[model samples]
Target: MTNSPVASPAQTAHSTGSICEFQPVIDELRRALNSTLKGKSEAVELVIACLLARGHLLLEDLPGLGKTTLAKALAMSVGGRFARVQCTPDLLPTDVTGFSIFNQKTREFEFIEGPVFSEVLLADEINRATPRTQSSLFEAMAERQVTIDKMTHRLTPSFFVIATQNPVDSHGAYPLPEAQLDRFAMKLTFGYPDRASELEMLAENIGAADRDRSPLPAILTPNSLQHLQDHVAGVHIQESVLRYLVDLGTATRHHRDVTLGLSPRGLLTWQRVAQARAHLRGRDFVTPDDIQDVAAPVLQVRLSGDFESPQTIIETVLNDVEVPVCS
Candidate 1:
């Protein structure tokens, strides 16, 4: 591993930290994806933020809502290798992590990498796969490595999995187990586009003669992305905000609606995402507001309940609990 130090002192200032140098890169990515994504700037930003934080995303929405498109756009924007896996009921664990194949010529078992080896992997209709097949990703998402035949193979540095599932219908779908759901850093819903945005999309399609004509261009290379990740890790997070994040995670465990709360890993993920969001906004340090802004998406799926809306439950809990003041 090569260590290249990037200085960010402006980020060390008090209250108002300096903006990250990668802000321009983030802007270019947003512009590149604007035409293809139409009208969801917030959703696009959240996805990019997750990627910068080195976290996985879980998109739960109705079909044809551009879940897969967003994943592809992110992958393209980073110029990374993209792979799509159509998970099914009969899909096996070996199919995802790849099985050892015997090479007759070499007379030795060779491991052939699967789609999971790519930088960006889109697991479309993930719920369609059985629990066994779905669990296959647990190791890859958590450890960034796949174990087969007692041997482990490390995945690419920018390995990310964007999983999409249809929430409207559960028929022929196996709900992801709790442990698997915990691995996702954030869960997002891409609702139907508003009338104006929908109209804009129609007009663009009509003029281009094809929907894919103006696909988003690559704005950053994989190396640059890894650099951004390094920058995010260096972003300064205040002790007050850190305490608040810990308090928030502890509060979730005691919430009435939640049977289980965000784990320590989930809390760390939340902290990292908050820092990433600040970096995207050209800031070098995190704030309470940043924590609040990212708390919903970071903890929504990790904290579960039998409430009407899991997202609503999280929001309510966050709103009701008082954030501890740092002395």
Candidate 2:
């Protein structure tokens, strides 16, 4: 792991007390992902934060960039059930949320679960699915459950989705709706690897056997993950820091280039993400640095405007808003 060392899991935990006792586990998770993802250390960290915050992730990049590998690595690290749905134009909503089957022998209906029932679901090339099929995920992503036949089924407690889409300009791809885009906690892109990392990858490829296998090791169970999420919820955010957060959201709304600013749900999502980042650093309370650290990625996913790029618009918003100094 080439990334700089974060706060020692031990030092910061005592200061933060019981609310953040699981910092060491998060540190371990970060190191594991860093090793698994190779040169994309920063992206791995953000993905871990998104998971800790209990939010879904969206990966936008070209094919063969290890998008699927990253998702699998995260799922394996937690020993979570990983299911994948390959989205195509003909995919139906029932295909994703599953359907009821009639048992001839028993003369009763049995509801067979779909890929969405797993803890970590990888929705690959989600844009290829029809809009109706895509809409099937909205309820599950927002409420962590699915509704079928006027009956609801609860997803796994650690339900986390990693949905990937090719660039909209690509043929056979559909642009994600604004509502669908908003459900993603953060959108990340993993570009080509650096020369050194690519060299390492080549070496690994040569050394591997005919069958490729996962290198990720499970470090936590579902219950342990739920506990860590509980701790993330307890990370403190003072009134001043929250006001600063609100200020950024408000500024985005008033930005001339923006057609739609951060929604109320988006703002709340940002706060939880910031809290997760802080908790990962072994801090119990939120800080402006934490907010700034995550501002670009979080805002980039949901913000829309007339700007040249979402990244540029987010950078401007960050500059326009004043940072709060917390004692």
Candidate 3:
């Protein structure tokens, strides 16, 4: 969970302007997400940072909390090809990775791709699927490719999976294995909307002629999103801040409440997310504040232990850890 070493903000700006130029895309995404997702600006911003960092996300919450809507809106806002697969026990691996069919005209087999071929995939009710079917996404998520009959098919450049699961019930659901959970960059919960936001949702539904009609639109292209990812990678992280990140990760490992701490991959993801957060704020270099802002979301799922609520546990851990001051 430690942060990596990066250049200072001044040094990064002096070296290049790529980070500065990518701000508009982040701004547009922020605005679009804010419009559709009222009263959840922090969650929306974290989701955008995950995308800009080329990381997958897991939205864990109860049913009908706008999880699917948010995923669809994010895919559309990035102008990426979006597909949704309702995960069920009967779903097969081939249903997601596609299968080869005999072509009479060509005298050979042709592979008909599946929903996984899309740029952004929404795996709704992911826990409802059998472990066999759930394991099917492992290859695509970790390697960005699907292997079928010894043939490997690479995914789109901006391939991202936003998976959703209902946390309240596990009666007929198969919990994601720890290994699979680790593949996700971050996990977030969309709690119930406040009174005012709930009222707005009711009002909006009252006037809508059809349920299919939604106001969200494509705001940014895939190419631009890829560029933004690159820009985030180039953002500066000072040595002191990097050490602070390292200290936090180390603390998690030694914390009495934590049975498991973040891995090196988790640490790298934490750093990347922090950099992306800084870029979203129109900063070329990352600050400790950026690390602190992103730490809870990026590391929450990575920490393991007995706690009343994982989110609350992470918040408590963050509050207990003393943030190192930088000169």
Best by TM-score: 2
Per-candidate TM-score against the hidden true structure: 0.89, 0.92, 0.89
lDDT of 2: 0.84
Q: Rate the local accuracy (lDDT) of all candidates.
A: 0.80, 0.84, 0.81
Which one wins on lDDT? 2
Q: Write the per-residue lDDT of candidate 2 for residues 1-327, one digit (tens) a residue.
A: 224353544333324345435656676788887776789988988998999899999998888888777777778878788888999999999999999999999999999998898889999999998899899987789999999999999997779999988874567877787878999999998888899998988888896773676566777777778877877888899999999999999989998999999999999999999999997777889999999899888988888878778888788878888888788
Could you tell me which 10 consecutive residues in candidate 2 have the lowest summed lDDT? Answer: 8-17
Q: Which residue pairs come into collision in candidate 1? A: 19-282
TM-score of 3: 0.89
Tell me the spans in candidate 3 whose CA falls farther than 4 Å from its real position: 1-18, 211-215, 311-316, 319-322
Going through the candidates in order, what is the number of backbone clashes in each?
Answer: 1, 0, 0
Model 3, span 1-327: residue lDDT tens: 114333432222223345544444566678888777887988998998898788999998888888877877888887788899999889999998899999999999999998889878999989999998888887888888999999999988789999998877788899987778888889898798889988887887785676668656666667666665777888888888888888778878777778878888888999999998888887788888998888777876688887655667666667777777766
Candidate 1 lDDT over residue span 1-327, tens digit each: 113333431122111223534545667787866656778888888888898899999999888888777778878878788889998888898888899999999999998888899889999989898887887787898889998888989998779999998888888998887878889999998799889999987876784664556655667777767766877888898777787788788888888888888899899999889988988777788877788888888887787776766677677767876775643
Per-residue lDDT, model 3, residue 11, is 29
Evaluated at residue 301, the lDDT of candidate 2 is 84
